[model samples]
Target: MNAGRPELSGTFGAVSSTHWLSSAAAMSVLERGGNAFDAAAAAGFVLQVVEPHFNGLGGDVPIVSYSAATQSVQVVCGQGPMPQAATIERFRSLGLEHIPGSGLLPAVVPGAFGAWMRMLAEHGTLPLADVLDHAIGYAENGFPLLAGAADAIEVLAPLFETEWTESGRVYLPDGRPPKAGALFRTPALATTYKRLLREAATAGGGREAQIAAAERAFYQGFVAEAIDSFVSSTAVLDATGRHHKGLLTGQDMADWRATVESPSSLSYRGLTVHKPGPWSQSPVFLQQLALLEGFDLHGMGLDSAEYIHTVTECAKLAFADREAWYGDPDHSDVPLDVLLSPAYTAARRALVEDKAAEVLRPGSPEGRTPFIPEQSAVDWPVADGSWMSQLANGLPTVVKATAARNDTCTIVVADRFGNLVAAVPSGGWLKSSPVVPGLGLSLGTRGQTMTLQEGHANSVGPGRRPRTTLSPSLVTKDGKPFMAFGTPGGDRQDQWTLGFFLAAVDFGLGLQAATETLAFHTDHFSASFTPHESRPKVLAVERNCDPEVIEELRSRGHDVEPAAEYSLGKVCAVAVDEKAGLLRAAASPRGRQTYAACR
Candidate 1:
């Protein structure tokens, strides 16, 4: 095992998250006799407060979990659908071809709050107030600001001050970004949560009723009224070079709620891996596994050039399929079964060659109509025009931006009762949209993932869920829960998690060692963000990887770019050894904020 960071072990329970405070909050819940669901919910709420630049109350979350009592796994689909007025015609009327990356026009019904509450009410032992205590405390009292969050505030300070005054009020206390490690508080957000609790208290019923009441307050009560009033009253400038009012309304929020669904999974090498359905880019991970099943990964060596090349190529192919076929299954007829079939995987695997393929190649599943939107140049302009300009020009920019505004948070919790949950909560970054007045939250800009082209599976339409990139991973071996792992890279979430999984299972590395290993990702497929740019045959590897390996990849027709050692991914994971009654958890050191705690 790698000696850098030891894997945390405990018999009682463990929690790992993208932030230390959130991890500590989860551990506190577990110590207080809460199960994995409760701990996860606590950590998730705390993450919203601490990692405000990554997620917020207006964000969406997708969770894959295992219940010890039922001995079954399920997915919590928290991604909200497009507003009733949000359609291709509306966007076209605004003279836009694609949804702007940052604006009210891209806002969706907030989904994370509903999803977290549902998880708590269905599987947790504690009440909504208990699970929300950590978040409320942090927001009310104050917490040390992280360097990443601070940097984000600094970068967007100009925009915040000039265009997004509400955001400036929350992020910049004295007309400036708070320095790293400085104590910071968002009293507005705290007040918002307190108001929800007060509304819940008025329900005068059981814990479930209280939770339901809180949900109603958020979706249909004061919170909804505030959002509707604000959006209706304002028109903000967005990436489309125009000011537009939001499409969301109180009726939209009242009509939507998170739902439970089956996970998309595939068995491989004695392990069964599970991910959220096509609505997310998760199934791409399973599809990658299917293609890799035919390879001898062990003999190739973990850090070998051949191994990296093979994995990169396979990711390109799978992600191409994601762009073409994967979408909200409720809105599109995704041929998931045919895509996951062994025969189909074999044919796809056969396309992987020693040399890199420099094109988008999505497999044609029999009898299924595939929809690949025409790749168009992204016209959305970044506020600063820094790294985004390079990306817009088809040049390789570092993945640091993926860690900043477009990033998400990952949580893996395992309690003493054997309940396990892996969730990726994301969407409402400070850069995505202006902060909602009074609520101190922003609506999600996930609608940027939808296409304007009519009839496309991921086309923007009323009530259609955008194909999100937030995918969490859960694994099982021999009919028992084995691991819950995830990371925070928009299109690279599954790519990084797959590398960590293979390192542990195929290379026999421990959780910590596996996560700390060199990370890399390919931009060969269409990106999930606005402009949907694709850099054919481009591969980015961390500087920690051997220079020889990088050179070898370039020699093989790969446009290899060197990234900062710790700029790749912030992956966190937890594993259970039921036979030994031990739980092991690990967090990536890349971002300096992720943490793993066990006791």
Candidate 2:
């Protein structure tokens, strides 16, 4: 297969990201002799500045990393828990059955900063100032805005001005949204970072101590004070069309910290695939792989009717389980061991029929009953009428209009010494919540992923993590680090990443070729966000797919919809060839800003 872009190859290091600037920043760190963790941390902060509509400093991140020295793979659990005041009763008092997708009420303890700081202090060689320089520069001096950011600002301009005035003050200058390619600056965000650095400098310790100081400033000191003051003083309009105060407080931030945990893994074809545990939807990827291992995927041609149908069916089963059984293990019994066991996967694999199944069916494992939420008849009004109206015109509109609301950013980095990091930094999108006054940041709406239904694994509760769709991928071949990859899609993250992995591993396609191949996903399970909607048996494939395959899928009881060629995913990947001591990277051409850098 001719990959639209040449696969990047380097002898020393490589980086791939959803944005060109972020990839370049990571590559620069690599050239400066920083390890993969340092490069990834720098790239992550840069992403917050360049992809403001997709992520920000107030967001959460989940990271998977491998170190040659330890020869172990670990997860950075950056998905923050709901605040102390976040309770089902409090939401019910406000007449809310589900958390709103855009508001302070759904804000969790911000996890990105704490996660990055921990990674830098423990595994990285660079100082906090070094890792944050790129982001601070872009925030203070300005960076060229991408078309997507400009378009999002344009769409949300009216809402910002009327309902989120603080956001308007930061995003719009002179009362107008910035145009694409225009230099945009957020001095307030730069100031916030600078203040943290200054506090770190005052600590008068080595690199580790300085990093700890910065972390304290963010969670226990000035940053926390600002966030607490804003939320305590304001009542803002959210997706509920009601003004509400936030549940998060300074104490909540002080109580939370990112921690390292063992990753959940499954072995297939002599490779071990790793993902975060049940706190995220990551284990669903491993579960799908377990089920897929029983099949001869190589015999099924790529994107063929049979191949697409089988993959879609397997995904439906896995996501059904995610909706039912997956949650914060600290709060719920996830039953991951039984869920990933060979016997259980074999049983789940038996459910995949030649014909598409148009229902949400979660199977019993170890005689444990699945906790599927009852489908509510309540109809919530679409937050944006014009955008929702456009969805009826065509299949492509389904993704284009909804992409910003459901998108995240991915980063993957590899160093010559055999260090690897794969991270998905997301949440706190510009449109998701109001910007914190004078901080140039917005709180995450991840709390929207929780349910109000009692006894459910993912029911809303204080200090519980909502089920997150942000997942990154890592694989080791023959006990050696092989690849790190991920993409930016809400529910489609695992689907797209799984396709990319299978194309490369099963069919022997190169990174670029695998990433560029036609992609498809199904909306069979309830969405992870607010107003959880489900479109049973619906499969949306890109226009690049063979028309015959599309028709054949439609013939197999699939409600097939046509997606634009470049609208499916924004995947980025890096592979390390241990024997050859070379690094390879690839970034999807689907988006204008995605890029790969190697040096």
Candidate 3:
């Protein structure tokens, strides 16, 4: 089955991590005759106000942009380096316990600012302040409470019980979380936005000016002083004798920038696929895709026994590589040249055993590098819901806790100028960071992904970035723009993305249909070398997948579990058919206020 270039459906397109404000900001940009880059920036800014847990201004951002004129796609690593003061010795000497979330210690340089500024500076035609007016207005004046935001705040009120340690203000007013549709205001946040606008206007009035304004305001001016004061008061670094370089410095703020890296590629199923350099999880994803492609995925059929088995086994194989060596490549050596080789992918995929548990780690081309990061052990036991019935028990089971949290938001935009942009901002979990008052903006606390232990691949170190999972991709097939997409849920991000790509291309679903389907992923790689993987083989799926499918998987000895709907992954995407000029978009329905639109 071949689909021709999609027809032009009147032209504007966008998708976001959540459904609520994504469409709002995208439409605003479209109405202004702005390009995809502008629309994406607008949407990302709007998201900072709409969904804080899933994203905020404090987190890091990475993007992949495509231009029809150039017929080329570029990737941006919107990750900030570890503070200069960060070191392995500091972590060990603390002797207090796990890296404390007390304040700036867990800080990573904020990248969303640099990404947005870069997009506007390089591709956007409109003024940065003009593009941000809508979001700034919304933040200052406040927007209606999204049912998702309200409900999430209610559930996580304990985190806001006290003022953010960095900024002495309560996250929730009067210790009460609001309900959906409530008028929530952030006067301090509004003030910050106004100051940024003022500085941008008074300065040279270019991308550099806008970025300078943000850095000075957030990292060195008012925001920096607040954070530095709080950290000093807390004595967080007393044991370590230093603080992260950019934590409260004019230099780090002035130097804040998103790195534009050279493109990297991997072969999957005879397709030459490229991903951003090591800043994101694109490497791990390429590994999984290559391993799965060797199995004839389209032939396995949707949710068929072979399909599930093949994908799961491939995940196990690929994840081994991920857990062992995947992290920010700038500070650590990743066997990328070896790992993505055709021979390596082929060997990893060949480990699938038909009609057998395949319970042992595959032996071949295994990583000899000795920097495997160790975590807690996993216990995978086989018990029966039906005393060895044909189907796995399918009972509700708690997914194991990883240091993971789903706090990223994404936006995809396409403009009439033939410019496409996909932006992913991670680290809205708000650990050790504070929200800018008037801006209603929160910075990223991304440094949390680092291990407190030394010599580990992800160990904390100055100028070294943490292993990031946010991968905003812009890809084409046979010389035409086809897809722009990303998701929340760290570690499993690319795994979830693989499902989305398969549904759209192999299953012939539209943007919405592809997004509505069931999804699943594995923690097998994150938990390496476990004696047994009692972890469920059948990932969380929609009830519609047919009970018989579960029965068959259980019959085959998979630990099947019924997961809360959409609990497995959060995904969003936007794609266009260049020949037809038709635009399409979708957001994860399983997520709160996750909405999308095309105009």
lDDT of 1 by residue, 1-599 (tens): 22288889999988899999999999999998889999999999998898887889999999999999989999999999999999899989878877777779888999999999888888989878889899999999999997768877876677678778898999999888899899999899999999999999998799999999999999999999999998888998676656789999989999999999989999989999999999999999999999998999999999789999999999998998998898888988889999999989999999999899988899899956567888677666654644233222211112354422226899999888988999999877777788989998988888888889988778888999999999999998887899999998888888898999999988999998898988888988777776677788888888778889889999999998777776678889999988788999999887777889998
Model 3 Cα shift for residue 359 (angstroms):
6.7
Higher-scoring candidate on TM-score, 1 or 3: 1
Q: Please identify which of the two predictions, 1 or 3, would achieve the higher lDDT against the true structure.
A: 1
Give me the displacement of residue 89 in model 3, in angstroms.
Answer: 1.0
Which numbered prediction scores highest in TM-score against the true structure?
2
Model 1 ranges with Cα > 4 A deviation: 1-3, 367-369, 380-406
Candidate 1 to truth, TM? 0.96
Ordering by TM-score = 2, 1, 3
Clashing residue pairs in candidate 2 (N, C-alpha, C atoms within 3 angstroms): none
Better of 2 and 3 by TM-score: 2
The alpha-carbon root-mean-square deviation between model 3 and the true structure, to one decimal in Å, is: 7.2
State how far residue 240 of model 3 sits from its true place (Å).
16
